[model samples]
Target: MYSFLQVLWFVLIAVLWTGYLTLEGFGLGSGMLLRRVARTDKERGAISKAIGPHWDGNEVWLLTAGGATFAAFPEWYATMFSGMYLALALILIALIVRICAIEWRKMVNSTKWRNVWDWAHTVSSWLVPLLFGVAFANLVQGMAIEVVDPSNPMTGVGPENVDLSVHVHNLTGGFFSLLTPFTLLGGVMLTAIFLSHGSLFLAMKLTDEMRERATKMATNTSIVSTGLTAIWALWAQFAFGGSQPLAWIPLAIAAILLIVSTAMTLTGRVRSAFFASFLGIAAAVAFIFTVMAPNVMKSSIHPAYSLTLWDASSSYATLSIMTVVAIILVPIVLAYTVWAYYVFRARISVEDVTPSGLLPYKIRAGENFLTAN
Candidate 1:
C-alpha cells in the first residue's frame, strides 16, 4: 500500500498537469486558429491580443508539473526525460519560436514581416498541441521500461571490501518507440479538443465579426473533438489494463459535458459554452490521473518493471518538506494568477488597437498588451 505522502504527491502532480492543459488549451487553440479563422491582420491581432497576456503564464504550470515530478518521483522523471528527450526538445523549440512570433508581431512596420511572423506563430501553435497530444497519449498507453544495475561501481574497504549498490535505475527506448495506435488517437483527439477550446475562447474574448467566426469554428470543432474524445476514452476503458471503472465513470460524464458545450456554443451562449468546455477538460484530466494512479509510468515491456507510486516516490522526509513549501506558495501563486486575469478581463477588438503594419503599435488602456508597439 502507498503512504499518504505518495498519494498526495501523485494527486498534486496530476493537478499541475490539469492546470496546464486547462489554462493553456485555449491559448494553444487560439494560436492554431490564427491563420485559418482569422482572415485579416486586425482579426489575427485580436486573436493574439486575446491570449498574449496569459500564454506565458499558462506555461508555468507545465514547468511546475515537470519540477514536481522530478522532486516527487525522481525515478519516473529520469526515465521519462531520457526516453522522450527529442520530443521534449522539439516542444521547447516550438514554444521558443511561437514566443518570438508573438513578441515580434508588432516590432516591425513591414506587412511582409507581420505576415511571416503570423505564419510562424500559427505553425508553432499547431505543433505544440499536436506534440503534447502525442506525448500525453504515450503516457496513457505506457512506455517500454526496464530497471538495470550500473555496470561499474566503487568499492570501499571497511574492515573488508564493501560494494556500493546504492544506485537503482530505470530506462526507456525513446519517444519514437512509443508511437502506437492508441497514443496516436489520443494525440488527434486532444488536438481537436484544444482547437474547439480555442474557438470558444476566441468567441468570448473577441467581438463582432471575429466573435462570429470564432463561434462558428468552436461549434464545428467541438463536434469533432467530442466524438474523438469519446472514442479515445472508451478505447482506454476496454483496451487498457490500467484503466479503472471509476475513471471511466468520469469520462462518460465528460462526454456529456462536451456535448452540452457544443450545443451551448451553437446556440450562442458563449460564456456557458466555455464553462462547459472547461468542466469537460477538467473531468477528462481527473479521469486520466485516476487511471494512472499507483503507477506513475507503466511499463509496456513488463508489468513488473512499472514505476508505481511506492517505487517512484522520494523519501518521506523530502516529501514532507516539499508539502510544507507547496502549501505556503501554491495559494499565493493562484491568487496572483486570478488577479492578473481579473485585471485583464475585458473583450478585445480590432478597434481597440492599431493594425500590425502601423507606424506605432499601441494598445488602449486596461487591455492586456502583447507588444510594446
Candidate 2:
C-alpha cells in the first residue's frame, strides 16, 4: 500500500509535468514565430490567428497539474506554495498577461491595440519559462526554513499541523548562502528545454516562408538545447553531485533523441524533427524528476523542516479515493483535450481572425478554414 502511494505520487508528478510541456509547448513556439513575423500588422495578425484558437485550452494543463498536486501531495503544495507565494503570484500574473495578449490581440480593429497585445504576449511568454525555471531551480536547490519541533521545542501551529514549521522568503532573499551555481544551472536547463519545445511548435504550426523560418529556428534551438543539457548533466553529476548514475540513463536516452531530432530538423524533416524534440524534452523532464525525486524541498535553515515524498503524501483512504476518481474523469479530460486539438489541427489562417465582407452564413463556407498540410 505504501509502495502504491509512492507510485501514484511519482506518476502524478510526471503526468503534470508532461501535460505542461505538451500543452504550453505550442504557445511558446507560436509566440517565438510571431515575434519574428514581418513588421506588418497583417502578418503579425496571421501569427496570432494561428495560435489563438488553442492557447487557453493549452493552459488547462496547469490547472490539472495544480489540482493533482493539491490532492495527491497536499503537504508539498502547502510548503512550496506558501513559502514561494510571491514568485507564484508573479507567475499567475504573467499567465494572465500571456492569455490576455493571445485573446485580446486580434479581437480589435485597431493596430495599436494589437501591437500592445503583441508586446504583452512576447514579454510574458518568454518570462513564464524563465521564472518557472527559477522556482523549480530553487526547489531543487532547496530553501531556508525555520523548523518547529513538537516534542522538544514544542513548536508549530497545532498538533495535527506541525509541518508548517518553515517559511520561504522572497524569490532570492539576501540570505548569506542564498545563491548556488547548481541552482542557476537548473534554471538555465529549464530555459533551454522550453525554448526548444517552443521551436518545434513553430515548425508544426506554420508553412511556406514562415514555415521554413520556423524549421530553421527549431533546428538551431534544438542543437543548442541538446548541447547545453548535456553539459549541465555532466556538471550536475560530477561537480554538483546533484544527479545519480541511474538518473543519467534516461538522460542519456533523451540526449540521443535530442541529437536525432536536431538532425531531422536540419534535414528539413519538420514533422519527424518535431516528434524528436518532443521525445527529448519528455525524457529530460523525466530524468530531472527522477534525479530530484527523494527530496522535494531541502532546507538550509533546518533539517527537520525538509520535506520528502513519504512525509508529504495524503493518507491511504484519500489516495484510494483519488485513484478511483482520477481513473474515471482523467480519461475524459484527456479525451476532450485530444479531440479539441484534433478538430483544430493544421495551420491557423489569416481569414479566421478577419471578418469577411459577407455575412456570418457565407463565412462558415468551406473556403476560410485552411489547415497547414
Candidate 3:
C-alpha cells in the first residue's frame, strides 16, 4: 500500500496541473484567436490587454506543478523527462518565444515587427497546448517502458558494485513513438477546447463588435470542442480505464459540462459559458488523474514493470517536510491569484487600446525622459 503522504502528494500534483491548464487555457486560446477574432491592430491590442494582466501570473502554477513532481516523484520525473527530452525542449522553446513576443510586441515602432511577433505568439500558443495534450494522452495510454538491471553494461550501468536486486523503469521509445493517432486526436481536442474557452472569456471581457465576434466564435468552437471531447473522453475511458472503473464519473461530468457550456454560449450567456468551460476542463483533468491512479507510469512492455505510486514517491521524511511547506504557501498563492483577477475585472474594447510601439513616445527638447509623451 502507498503511504498517506504519497497519495496526498499525487493528489496535490494533479491539482497543480489542473490549475495550470484551466487558468492558462483561456490565455493560450486568446493568443491563437489573436488574428482570427481581431481585424485591426487596435482590436488585437484590446484582446491582448484582456489577458495581459493574468497570463504571466497564471504560469506560476505550471512551474509549481513541475517542481512538485520533481520533488515528490523524482524517479517518474527522471524517466518522463529523459523519454520526452526533444518534445519538452520544443515546448520550452515555444514558450520562450511566446513570452518574448507578448512582452516586446509594442517595444518597436515597425508594423512588420509587430506582425512578426503576433504570428509568433499565435504559433507558440497553439504549439504548447498541442504538445501538452499529446504528452498527457501518452501518459494515460502507457509508454514503451522496461525494467533493466543496473549491472548490465549495454543498459549504460557500470557493473562494479551495482545492486542486482534493484531495477529501474526506463522509457525505450524514441520521440516519433509519441505520435500515435489517439495522441494526435488528443492534441486537436485540447486545441479546440482552449479556443472555445478563450472565445468565451473574450466574449465576457470585451464589448461591442469584439464581443459579438467572440460570442459567435465561442458558440462554434464550443460545439466543436464538445463533440471532440466526447470522442476523446469515451475512447480514453473505454480503452485504458478498465483498472479504474469509477473514473467514469468525472469523465461524464466533463462531457455534460461541455454540452451545457455550448448551450450557454449559443444562448448569449457568456459568463456562464466561460464558467462551465472552466469546470469542464477541471473535471476532465480530474478524470485523467483518476484513471492514472495506483501507477504513476504504466509500462507497455509488461504490467509488472509499471511504476506504482510507492515506487515513484520520495522518502517519507522528504514528503513530510514538503507537506508542511505546501500547507503554508498554497493558500496564500491562491488568495493572491483571486485578488489579482478581481482587481483587473473590467471589460475592454478597441477604443480602450491606446497607441502602442516606440513611435508613439516622442520627447521634446525640454522634456525629460520621465515626462516624455
Candidate 2 has an lDDT of: 0.68
- Best of the candidates, lDDT: 3
Query: For all the candidates, what are their Cα RMSDs to the real structure?
Result: 6.4, 7.1, 3.7
The regions of model 3 sitting more than 4 angstroms off are 153-165, 358-373
User: What is each predicted model's overall lDDT from 0 to 1?
Assistant: 0.82, 0.68, 0.87
True lDDT of residue 342, candidate 2: 86
> How many residue-pair clashes does candidate 2 contain?
1
**Residue 294 CA displacement from its true place in model 3, Å:** 1.0
Task: Write candidate 3's Cα lDDT for 22-140 as tens digits.
Answer: 99999999999999989888788888888888988899999999999999999889889998999999999988998888888887566777788889999999999999999988888
Q: Residue 84: error of model 2 in Å?
A: 1.4
Across 1-373, the per-residue lDDT of candidate 2 in tens digits comes to: 9767766766777777777776686676567556774346666676776667777777777887788778877877877787677767888998898888877775545667778888888878777776676666566556765444435443333323445434221212333333467666665666677677666676676556666666677777877877877887666556423445677787788889988988887888878877887777777767766666675666655445567677667788888888888889878878987898788777854444463212222234455533311
Top candidate, metric TM-score: 3
List the candidates' TM-scores in order. 0.89, 0.83, 0.93
Per-residue lDDT for 144-240 in model 1, tens only?
A: 7665545642321231222224434455466568688888888889889999999999988889988889898988898899999999988876776
Over the full model, what C-alpha lDDT does candidate 1 score relative to the true structure?
A: 0.82
Location of the lowest summed lDDT over 10 successive residues in candidate 1: 155-164
Q: What pairs collide in candidate 3? A: none
